[model samples]
Target: MHTPASMVTGIVFAPLGLVLVFTAAITPQWREGQARLGASGPGSPLRSGAKGQGKGGARPASAGALLLLRSDGLWESCLQVENSELKQCWPVAGSYRRDPRVRLAQGFILTSLFLCGTGIMLACIGVRCWTDTPLRGVAATGGLLVVIAGLLSLTALSVYTHNLPRLGMADPSKAIKSARFPRLSLHPAGSLYFGWLGSCLQMLGGSALLFSFKRPAYPDCPSCLKLRVCPACRPCPEIPNRPDNDVYEVSC
Candidate 1:
């Protein structure tokens, strides 16, 4: 939500997005079924890992599923089923779902960065208005909002991190990995908390700054110092792709 610090936020977050996308794209592209355990070739039932130790052939319950069992302290993968006529090898687990916190964190970082970056672009306009004319009535609130929101984000993140010791598991938070079974980890939880906090600040700050961009700035005319007048027309047309000042007024 922090929109003011676009450049700073954008630079920091873009790399994270790229890293996640690359990891997603390259996740074990090879099919599990075709990959043999312990480099076994065709017709060889035995798998290399400790996971496939015992319970060969198949169980009567499942029709066409690989049965994993341990026997005599060894692991084995069951290739064929004993009962049903169906002939199929055991399937390797591959289901992966999106985590909401991760998604939110990603969005928050990216958005805040964008907002911050935009602030840089509009800096010139703000300066121009200050010099050329009097500040508009509406302009003051937006700038204040951006500063306040950014502070709020920092506060939220700090609170979340402070509370982490209460909610985290016994395992080392740093050891959590992409291949974890439960998927959720204290690392990510912490990251999400801080990430959202920063982003919200950025969103609010950036929004406030964005609002200030269009607000009319008035300055005393050079010749007529006594009478105050709006500065040269607001540079709305110059600013690229800013959000609307409000819901009802659609102007960017």
Candidate 2:
């Protein structure tokens, strides 16, 4: 059986989208910020003797005006000193985890992943190329699920983006609150871009699959199935000449 072009497109792009979204979800770079610390200031974030702070459990800080980088994701957070190998990572907790927006993003993204995975399985089963006629309806149903998953992912991304700066605001350890260097800012990071791209690809793939719902036109031939005849190559039968004057035959 010849596979429809749309089905092939959906098969290719949907998996790629799924991979990208999964990568984004597992990564800890959803949002990142850098704060410059002063070694000499009493309120310095990285002061040698200062207590540990933030959702990521703290380790020792380098004694300098070095930049402190923080990254946050759905499940984990990481912190590192600029240009240094000293890094600490931990699962997301505290007020940040409890935040409504964070919880919403987490739920939406997780659900999206689950739905997309299930949809892909359905699509694979429906794309039975060995059969004479493919299950276009089943394939289309999968496509709809994939499309919904993409939308959910997109919603998660949007919520996280619009509330990026406010996500970890409850953390008292933020350098922005420090008087020494108060200009620290947080912004969307690499993972968000990956998610956005994946969402787009998912939508495109699902739409392509949806097109398969339309039936293809074929020439009328009773033996065409067994002969595996191409519609274009199959010739129509000619009408037989009749001897009866009253008898009439007409081709529509």
Candidate 3:
């Protein structure tokens, strides 16, 4: 049995892509930023209401304050103070989880994972190297599914990235006042880079697999060199003799 080159490429790329995507989904570094904690630093008695603080305390200066590193992911968020053991993490909740873009991203990523898994299974079954010929249609179908899954993941990443800062900003009233909220600038993090790369690999693998839809070319016959014939149309080694008494008529 001969395996198509595309099948091999797909087999190699699809699994790597799946691994990366899964890793990104489980990690909590989609977006990250550092917050200069002033009076809101840990153990501060004035942590609750910075709004009531006098002008002196309301300053957003970072002197003698801890820098809190915050990170957000599809499932959870984490915060840790630089050069300190203080760390906190929790599942996404409140307005963050309820945000339309966040919910869509979650759904899209889940669906993409499921579909990609199913497609990989189908591809494995279809790429039956033990058989004389591969199941081209089945392999192509799996490829299509994988391509769609990649597209879904790409969409989810795009939505999340484009609205990273606005994800949990549905309620403006809940936002910390500028005076108290330290200088926090968010940016795409490691997990997002992983996801983008994974999605690209998925698309490339699926596209390669899609080539399986075309029939494999047949090798030229040894008896008649340079002449090619499809397997189904090739002449058999032996032809049964027709009865001499029977007359046959042929029409073009």
Report the C-alpha lDDT of model 1 over 1-252, residue by residue, as the tens digit. 112343234233333433332232223211112111221333324332222333454334432223322110001112332342434333222111132322332344344344344443343334333343423223333344344434443443444345433322333455444321223222222234334544454454444444444543355444434434432333222223357531121221
* lDDT by residue for model 2 (25-110), tens: 99999999897766667656566433333233554345446677889999999988775556899999888899899999999999
Which residue ranges in model 1 land beyond 4 Å of their true spot?
A: 1-98, 129-131, 134-252
Residue 65 CA error for candidate 2 (Å)? 0.9
Candidate 2 vs candidate 3: the lDDT winner is 2
Off by over 4 Å in 3: 39-63, 178-183, 222-252
**Clashing residue pairs found in predicted model 2:** none
Global Cα lDDT for candidate 2 = 0.79
TM-score of each: 0.27, 0.78, 0.79
The prediction achieving the highest lDDT against the true structure is 2
